[model samples]
Target: MSEPLLLEARGVGKSFPGVRALQDMHIELRRGEVLALVGENGAGKSTLMKLLSGIYTPDEGEFFLDGEPLRATGPRHALELGISIIHQEFNLMPDLTVAQNIFIGREPRTGRVFLGERALEAKAAELIDRLHLPLDPKERVGELTVAKQQMVEIAKALSYEPRVLIMDEPTAALNDAEVRVLHDLIRRFRTPDTGVIYISHRMDELKAITDRITVIRDGRYVDTLDTEGTTMPEVISRMVGREIAAGLGPEGVREDREVVLSVRGLTTKDLLRDVSFELREGEILGFAGLMGAGRTEVARALVGADPVESGTVELRGQPVRITTPAEAAKHRIGYLSEDRKHLGLLLEQDVNANIGLSSIRERFQQWGFVRDRAMRARSREIVDTLRIRTPSVDQTAKFLSGGNQQKVVIGKWLVKDCDILIFDEPTRGIDVGAKEEIYRLLNELAAQGKSIIMISSELPEVLRMSHRVVVMSEGRVTGQLDAAEATQESVMHLATLRPETEAVS
Candidate 1:
């Protein structure tokens, strides 16, 4: 008989109030194979993983592990059955040591009252050594960098001797070098005893590490293709279920209009130095760089969130002194932060509330009397235009899906009617559908004469969406590429282009 699959799900299905999150989805993973689960945002990647990891029990379907039917009531039950999931966000306790985190609930015990610290450390050390990770068992979890923290989480999962491992967006925060490291680590897990399910938006990484590519669209099984021969364009086509046309590059854009914002001889302490650029009206300008390459710093300085030691920001050829966000807003400049959860919206508030958050005072009447109806109407207008999906205008922003929440934040800025907008990692956690929607909205805004600067880590998004791309490395602009001339290789080269200290000076 042929070897049974390591794990399999049959007719897996789930439903929310207004959406079918998973519809008759089916998948299988072999003992030694890495299966890549890919789809646009809201393609049910996370929902399916939650089913596999027991975070959410499937309302319909049967799961089999090692040829035996299995059901888990919770994550702990899944762990007991040799299944583990390492989420995108690290779940380490700040106060706990690496060893303590690894052995949290299942710590070794010498007796009923005595804790076996030495044994626990030894076990943690063994897992670390096996994984070839350079983490100190005694080190506090909070002190580690994002990559290191991810390593710790992986080590903790491996501590269970898991037969199945689910990794979600494992390289989202990693730089190129760090991504290389992660790719190497993932390769080591392709052993005869372990089956891994990898979920990511990055097609290149998926192609590199995964043995098989499974495409899902609208929570339904699309197809499973051989990763070695499948093209990215084909995969994206399957995920989106539509033929997406090429985007307008800088040459394709109408640049006859005057420059809306210009930065001359821009310098900031350590983080940004001698940065200079000109943004044209009705254009989408992109900043491409690896993490810590000073893109966010540049945005922060430009918007007066960070103080600049030198450089003048000129609006339509006239110098403007922007000392604060309020001042910048007065000049019709707005910034949408990358870290949206903390900086962009009031998570607990409703959609209407978040949309009107920035200009609440203005929408109110005299003597600080709030005009609730006017604010809701304005919020509704933005929501309808931007296609923000919420149960109601009063629906809490935090409860909406990642894509919808992002739209609400975008709506806030749109309602503000800023002429020059800076979007930093705008689609970080959003699904593919929402990403397309955001891209459409951006193009519409640019077509409507809004000058935009987009900072993105994904090179494809930068290449596909921007009219012009500017690459930064080590606090300096390395090269400028018209979108037509920009490819993944050219952009990567410039993104990694590190100039000498003297050149930067």
Candidate 2:
């Protein structure tokens, strides 16, 4: 007969204060298969993963592993029972080395008295080598890039050698190449005795790697579909309970608009070199490139977060020297960083505090005193405008989903009324439905005469949202194309254009 299911959850229900996080949720994972779980942000995806990982005890229902009832008291217990989870947000200790972070609690020891640093590092090195990861075991985690840190998280989860693996938005920080490596590793991990539950909002990836797609909506199970038999549009419709239009891109060119900001010969000490571009009023300018192509560095340099070696920035034909983010703010330029958790949002604060933060001194302060009532009123208005899924403005920022947290950051800049906005990977870890909302919001802002510079690694996003696309390669502007001229093939060609080829051209 057929083999038993690898993992299953039945009638699962969970509730929190003022939130019915999940109710009547169910899923089944067959042996040797990759099952993709998809839904909009705050649709009980992470909540279910937490329940499976022993981070939370379900108020009702049961979980079965290998046809046996499975109950875990805590995360450690769950790991001991052959279940491991990699959360979306990182849990690495920044001060520690890679090896230490990977095997923190379980370290080799000499007779249980002294820690074996070399042995620990050697073990980590072997794992990294086996996974084809470019990482140094002795390197400090805080010194590593966000992409590398994500790799470390994957390594840590795999170190447990669990029978069932659950990964939540595992590729949010990864590029195309890194994603390939991760997919290969996942393939190697899958066996007849093991199964995987892959949770992500990247529909393309779900098609590439998963065997079955299970959709959940509003904290409840929707339907499962065979990957080969389903279309992405159908899956999305099931996810959001409606039909969404396809091929949504820039409406038209903005060539006739006035140039509001111009950069010439932009260079940084590390990577950026001779980057130049112009952003028009009420235009959406896109920055596109491969990983390490210095796209993020351009945004950082423009905002004065990174020191620029040589460059000239002009606002409406007048040159301006901005040496700090405060100066950029003075010029009404707001930068929303890609690393939103660490750089964009104040996780410890509430939604109101985060939304009102950038405008406090100018809009919510009087006579050296903070105005709480006015701030709350304005924060509520932004909350409604952005449709941030928070119970109240007083809810902690950390408690919101990744998409809502991103919206909170956007709301911060909107409250400041910045005329020039830079969004760096604005939809990095957000779901499809939320991405649509963010896209709509961006178009709305541009129509309101706010200039936007959108830096994204996703080529489709750049092609869809940009009025003019600027392609960068090895820290230099390789080419600029209007919406009509920018295609996947054309953009990729310029993205791979090297300095030698650029000089030749």
Candidate 3:
């Protein structure tokens, strides 16, 4: 007989202001199998997970654990009931050690009031060791790399010994090697005692790791499929509700391009070691690297989001000091950060305000006063131009779908008329359909003579979108590849190739 369902979300429904995020969503995760929860960014996936985790109590429906109705009052209550989630955005105290972070509230005590550090580290080490994760339990989370921090999150979740473990975009920030570790752990956890709800936009992971796929669109359950019985094309089509023309073909490359953005000896905060590269007009140059390898750092430094210790940035053959994001904006350089919710958009603000923010003073200003009509008009144009699906331009960014929110960020740059665009993981939390949209936008921008520095963790994305690729390791550019010459093997080799000084990194 088949194993009993470990956890089930029964007719779940949830709503936010101006958004019906989830409705009548039903999903069953059976023991020993990994179930993929996938949909476009605003497809109610996050809302459903929140309901399952007790982060949000569903407006309707119920949850069942081992055929019993779960009465979880909050996230803590759910954790105690053996439901654990490793969030897409990490939720750890940076100042705390891995052991402390892992078993924060439930630390072992030496006496009535004192905690036993050794016992805590011992337990954390045991968990990390079991997973064969390369992480030091006693080390501070702040000192760890992004990939390592993700490992810590995994260890923390596993520490709960959860019957239902929910992983949201777990491998989003991990490299190929690091992803293998997670893959192995997933296989190891797929026993009669445990079930995993894996959420990700990456297609390959779903095919390899999941036993079944559950799709939700526009806050409603669409269908579910056995992994072995379906294909990605069909899966994507269902999630998007339309037939998508598959992948992009080789585009026309400029034979001879003029230099647009040039960085010489770009070193930053001891993370970036003598990083140097050049971008040509109408070129899509990709920055590929493992987490914390300084691809993001390089982009940040160029756009002055982070401090630059020593370097020279020349825009269109003119040396300029981009000391701040404002200065970068003045130079018409736009950076769409990988961490969009935190770094890119004002979540509480309306779409109109966000789209006009970067260009506030120049585009929608009049005599020290803002012109509301012009700003709204521009926002409406961009919303239509970018095909941003929203109720209206007045919709709060926090209420929009993840894919639409990302488009709002891009809209901000277009409003500013930015010539140099740096997109860091443009499609990180986006779905297959949205990913194609973003790719098409990038191609269109490059064709229109915009210089783009695309930073991505996905090798396939890098290969597909970029005309040239720069690979980084241990905060340094290890190698560069032409579009025709780059392969997964070649990129992975450079991406994992560490510098001698930072061998541990």
Candidate 4:
């Protein structure tokens, strides 16, 4: 006989003003199995997770645990009742140590009043060691790398020892090695009485770690399939309600094209060294490397978000001095950051306000007054063009899904009419359908004579979207390859080449 259902949601529905976020959503998680839940952005995936985690109560329907009706009052209550959720956006306290963040409210104490730092760290250390995660319990979360911070989040979730664990885009920021470690942990977490609900946009990972797949679209349940019996394209088709076209390879740029941006010997005090590259007009330049390979650093240093100790930047054969982001913007350059929540979008603001931020003074100000009407009109146009799923332009950005939030960031830069655009991990947490849309948009922008620098960790994304690829390693440019020459093997070979090793070769 099959294992009993560990968790089940029956006809669950939720709604907010101006948005029917979810309706008649159903999911089942069997004991000792990892269940994959997938849908396009704004397809009610997040809403369902929130309801299951007790962040939101369903307006209708009910949930059950072990065949018992379950009703949780809040997140804490859910945790107490054997449910823990790790959200895509972190809930960590930057200034606190990993140990403190892991056991914030339930820390061991002396005399029931004084905090016991040593005991807390010891507990965290034991948990980390148990999970085989490479993390220092005493290290400040703010000082850790993004991948390490992700590990801390995992540690915190697993510390709850809940019967049901919900992880949202847990591997979005992780590298291959880190991802392997996570998969191992998930395998170890599986037990006869516990189960996992793994939400992700990555199909390959779903195949590797999940037993069954559940597809939801537009806030409703579609179907569920055994992972091994179904294909990715089939799953995607159901998720988007259409057949997505096959991947399109990048077309090479002409050598005669004008060079729009030139960086020669770009060096930063921290991690970049003598990085040199030229971006041609109407070209999509891809930067690819492993974690800490300085791809992001290059983008940051180029846009003056980070100081360059030694380097020269030239625009159209004319040298330019850019020491701040405002100066970069003045030069008609825009950067879409990888950390959208922290760096790209103003979450508290509405969609219209966030989309018009970059071009506010130029396009929305008249006689020292803000032109709110014109701003909303422009935002509406971009929203429709980008197919951003929101109730209206007046909707708060924080209410939108991760992919839609990313689109808003893109719209802000588009409204600015920047000649040169830098997109860092533009589809980091976005679904496959949204990724295809962004790819098409990038190609269209390049066809419109705009130069783009795309930094991505996904090799397939880089190979598919870049006219030329720049490989980085150990804070230096290891190799540059044209579209025809860039392959996964070639890029990985260059990305792993250390400066000293390259020099010796």
Q: What are the lDDT scores of the predictions, listed in order? A: 0.83, 0.88, 0.85, 0.88
Candidate 4 displacement at residue 295 in angstroms: 12
The 10-residue segment of model 1 with minimum total lDDT is: 496-505
lDDT by residue (414-489, candidate 2, tens digit) is: 9999999999999998889999999999999999999999999777788889988898876788898777766665
* lDDT winner between candidates 1 and 4: 4
TM-score of 3: 0.61
Clashes of 4: 0
TM-score (all chains, Cα) for each model:
0.69, 0.60, 0.61, 0.61
lDDT score of model 3? 0.85
CA deviation > 4 Å runs, candidate 3: 1-4, 110-115, 244-302, 307-314, 317-321, 329-505
Candidate 1: tens digits of C-alpha lDDT, residues 264-335: 888897568778998998999999876667899999998889899999889999999887888887787889
Compose the digit string of candidate 4's lDDT tens values, residues 421-478.
9999999978889898899899999999999999998777888899998988768888
- For this target, which candidate reaches the highest TM-score against the unseen true structure? 1
Candidate 3 on 26-125: residue-level lDDT in tens? 9999888899998765688888888888889888888899888986889999899999999999999999999999998888875676457888888888
Ranking by lDDT: 2, 4, 3, 1
